[model samples]
Target: MKKTNILKNGALGALVLSVTFGCASTQQEEPAAAPAAKKDTACQAELAAAEAARKKAASVGGEWRDTGKILKSAKKALAAGDVAECIKLANKARRQGEMGYAQALEQRDNDVNSYTVERGDNLWNISGKDSIYGDPYQWPLIYKANRSQIKDADLIYPGQDLSIDRAVTSAAVNAAVQHAKTRGAWALGVVEESDKAYLAR
Candidate 1:
């Protein structure tokens, strides 16, 4: 029995010593950290600036340059005596004109007459007195109006007593005397020269 108790005590002591030394000699390791995520933040900022510049360039090119080109073409056509072509260019230049190209276009065709043929009357005398006609070539319109009485568009003689009633009106009578006093036939309305008196009432 003494021998068996001595062996058991020796084994228990060995087991306790092994456990204590193992605990004291053990080392702790640090945990692994996750890698930081990669980002394209600079690329995102560059893309935003490029898009804004593209839009601004498009707006400037489409508005001013395009409109100015059309107006320039219209002025060229007018100088070339292509009245109809000039009018078309003017319409395209509409966006650029501050006061409106449209109003000026509307007035271009409106020619007003101030006198009708009379006995021994000719294009020279008629155009001479009328400022709107400016030249004898425009006499065709006057001749057209009096075609029935004049017999021919080109051949009009004096004392024919043709209708000046078209150009003559109470307003003209007033203007003739008024201008004599004013030194110029200003303050006269073009509508009064074309006199739609019957329509006015």
Candidate 2:
């Protein structure tokens, strides 16, 4: 009877201690969170640097998707006094900006703005690819740049090498998009008059 009572008392004591420690740990973590989420002096500077890098990437037409979104969230975290979250998100945004700028630089310095035509590839679809211009309306830019290899804007053959002008100005891109949007109906295997006018420009 004594041994049984001692064992029962020990089990109860263990359960009580476990519950006590759990509560204590939660309380400690709660207080730590209050301090952890507080603002840091370097956080704003980090956000600024990230924004600058993102702008540089945009200048080179190399800004990746969702970078602005992440940077915006970092600002929200900063306003909410979530310094840790702001720093984490800011770091991620900064890396994206830096990598985007690097991608543009590499694409410019190296002749990486060329695409190999597939059997079913068309300029509209090829220009819409992420590695290319990512806009179907920019197909005229591809057709205009590859006039030597492409006789017709609407006709592209497999194994044909298409040159892409990655160093285009914002004005040129806008022009290409505008032209593609306003272009008339096309006859296959023949260059459209509208394409000739666009390429002339």
What's the lDDT for all of these models?
0.44, 0.86
Candidate 2 structure lDDT: 0.86
- In order, what is each prediction's RMSD in angstroms? 26.0, 13.0
- Which runs in model 1 stand beyond 4 Å of their true positions? 1-70, 73-120, 159-201
Model 1 backbone overlap count: 7
- Index of the highest-TM-score prediction: 2
Q: Per-residue CA lDDT of candidate 2, range 1-201, in tens? A: 999999999999999999999999998889776554445666887899899988888878777899999999999998987888998998898999899999988877765578999989999999998788878899988988888888988888999988888888657888999998889898998788888899899
| Tens-digit lDDT string for candidate 1 (71-151) | 556667656755566666665454344223333333333434345457766744564444334444334335344546654
Query: Positional deviation of 13 in candidate 2, in angstroms?
Result: 56
